[model samples]
Target: MEIVQVLHMNGGSGDTSYATNSILQKQVITKAKPVVIGSISDLYTTNPSPCLRVADLGCSSGPNTLLVITEIIEAIDEICHQLNHNTPEFQVFLNDLPSNDFNAIFKTLPAFYEQLRKEKGEKFGPCSIMGIPGSFYERLFPTATIDFLHSSYSLQWLSQVPPMVEINKGNIYLARMSPPSVLQAYTDQFRKDFSLFLRLRSNEITPTGRMVLTLLGKKSEGPFGKECYFWELLSKSLNDLVSEGLIEEAKVDSFNLPFYMPSRKEVEAIVCGEGSFYLDGLEIFDINWDGSDDDDNKKFKFDRFISGQKVAKLIRAVTEPLIAYHFGDAVIDVLFNRYMEYVSDHLSKEEGKFVNFVISLKRK
Candidate 1:
């Protein structure tokens, strides 16, 4: 539950004016439709009166959470309309770690509420929104009360210290590549975190509730998940620095990521381990793959490979904490700037990397 909350050049947060809401809106709305429907299908029936409670676990501050809540509600509204029933009065609970900035989220609520009220959506009902901040690895809401749960780019976070990481030794949390010791520790942490998640939710989710999750996962045999390439590179780079006495080994050893990425098998096992949920449907797809042309066939002419500074900002926002934790805080910016250069160089030689994953689990 304890995580090092450090910030550097990073993307936006709801709390910060980074416009994460826009990024989240773009990222989640498109990919979440299927899972949203799947979750709704589990609990919705052809009844005139609709009663549903949905939770967005690890819902970060600002626009992303609010946008996702809307997308999910709209999906449910479609289902309700298809069955030809009055829309339900929905209660949406957005939860995250206490460290997350809820004040910003609350500040945006009136606008979000007003926006929803003004828009004539397919799902037209008074939505009750509340902020519940806490750890998802532990207890969440009341027993047998939740109808749907959704977590995105979250769950991959490990629950505790990775077992194989020895603080005493110089290795710290850097996953070993050949033997996969660090990876094993990370996997174990995920297993523990996920088990706790399911157990906690088992008490809260109704008999036929559904949960949809998306996390960065790996298809590579590499030590880090494909989604975590930057982190892996950063870790190894620091270790290299330690080997050369350019940086302190002690500093490198002191660092670890509270978050991680999981494999499809790893995720499936977590849901199955609970025994209360079934994998009704699943999907794995690439996101942000820099195609020769964008989805709308809009060609971005970046003389550099990464296209724009926005991509740079995103990686910086997400990786600065990890970078600063290992290397001196002094070099965090330099490290990512170097990484961006490499990204440009590499993309010129080859296409940029792709992120893949599975989204699953439908309760019976």
Candidate 2:
């Protein structure tokens, strides 16, 4: 499958659209806020450029897209106020694949600009926002043009599915049941893609520039871990359809996700081997599948069915395009319904959590 052409969140503002179902992503960004603020503040205070150029790579459309930019601008504004420095103009670039909902983001610009004017006053950042469409694995900007960079919940997506991953039959991603060859194929692909990513960004960002990246990661050092459980449930759901004769078994066998959740060790090795950036800070944290469920009160009544539906919607919004492209649209509703059931059963047995890695880097 052509990932660049087909890979995009469900667009528009409808119920199943990414714009509406992205609270999980929004929670991730909020959790990583301090890292983002520190990175932006440090970069600007150290360099003090008159016009700061920033890019949000893999910035899929919706409120979350601008949410990152607003946070960065506000951080910079606060630092400038404290330092008695004039607020610098901003050149913000929101980048994602060509198929992403750039129009959805574009339509919100007027209100965003108005909000900035009202909050920061007239003299505040004439921040110019533009949409750049392409793959981050390839160079998207000129040399030394960007001063700061940010990407959240995006890098786990490989540039393309590994060529040999068809061997990973029955399961979509790296699962405990996958063969050793499938595991190696996935690991090799992630190393290649991530190394190229760092190299490309090293070229685009200034020497003094810094980057803050957050993505799904795994707690274990091995290829298969708890992180694979999410995809496994989806696979089971598809297999249930297969049992019902809705989808062909061979189709499930051939299908594999273009995603890999790296371990912290894997990430550090790639950054060190790439030889371009200094890893200033790296952290691994856990978030529940239901973004809104933060409390640990045992006395509180937790509705597993409701939480399962919520999680299913979030995954469906992100993966429906790819699934539809692969298996046709007829299977979407049934597939997710079964998926919700599986997830709900799993939650009833035990809570599920996603591991996330947030890293701060500077060009060496």
Candidate 3:
């Protein structure tokens, strides 16, 4: 698949839109707040300036994109206050693929700036927010232009579907049923994409600049862990549609997700091997599938708030566009409805967990 053209979160603020259903991604940004603050803090420690250059890679359009920008600026403001330094004018770049809903982001900027001026005073003179549309796997800015770089919940997406995936049939992602070769293909793709990412960022960032990245990752060596079941059930749901003759089996055979959740070891090896940056800090944590809405007090219980429908909607919001692009719109609702039932049934058996990796890095 050509991921740059096909991959984007469901757009606009509707029930099934990514803007409305990205609570989980928002929580991820929150979880990475400390790393982000530290990166900014370390950035200004050596290169204190009246102007700052920052970029948020894979910044899909929505409130979350702006929220991340606002938080970074706030962190910088607080750090400058603590260091007795002057607050810097900001030049922020919001980047994603060309097809991303940048218009949505632009529409919110006037109000965002107005709110910023009201809070930070008119003396917060010159802050420029520019939208840059491109894949982060390559260079997007001039050399040594960026002071800080941040990407959250986006790196896990491979630049494209693995080349060998045609040999692995009937699975949408790397799952328990996928053969060893399929897993190896995914691992290889991630290694290549991530290495390129580091190389590009190393070029764009100043010597003292730092970056914080939060993405889905695995603790175990095996691909099939807690979150694999989500895909397993989703695959089952799609198979059910095929069984009903709602869609062709060939369509399913050709479909595969351009995503990979790397293990901590795998991540460490790639970053170390890339030789562009050194890992400043690394952390791995677990979050519930439904944005950590699990009520441990009622583990055996099930409710609408933590229902399969919610999880299915979240997945649909992020994935429907891609699936529809390949499978046609007629089956979109039916596919997700079946997925909801499967998710509900599976969640009833066990609470779903997603492992996330948050790493802080500095350019060499």
Candidate 2 regions with alpha-carbon error over 4 angstroms: 296-300
- Superposed model 3: Cα runs more than 4 Å off: 294-306
Per-candidate count of clashing residue pairs (backbone under 3 Å): 6, 0, 0
Candidate 1 residue-wise lDDT, 71-136, digit = tens:
777776777678777778889898877656677778887887777777746447778889887778
The TM-score between candidate 3 and the true structure equals 0.96
Model 3, 1-364: lDDT tens digits are 6788989999999889999888888878887887788778777777787889889998997779887788878887787778776789999999999989999999999999999999887876378999999999878999999989999999999999888834566788877778888888898999999999999999899888899999998788766766567887888888898899998998887888999888888899999999999999899877777775455536765564456777898899889989999989999999998888888777777778888999999899
Strongest candidate by lDDT: 2
lDDT of 1 at 218: 68
Over 4 Å off in model 1, which ranges? 4-25, 46-49, 82-84, 121-124, 165-179, 220-227, 236-247, 289-298, 302-305, 321-329
Question: Candidate 3, overall lDDT?
Answer: 0.86
Better of 2 and 3 by TM-score: 2
In the range 9-128, model 2's lDDT, one tens digit per residue, is 999989889999999899999999999998888888888999999999999988899998999889999998999988999999999999998988899999999989999999896899
lDDT of 1 at 344: 61
Computed on alpha carbons, the lDDT of every model, listed in order, comes to 0.63, 0.92, 0.86
Superposed by TM-score, candidate 2 places the C-alpha of residue 332 at a distance from the truth, in angstroms, of: 0.3
In model 2, the Cα lDDT at residue 43 comes to 89
Per TM-score, the best of the predicted structures is: 2
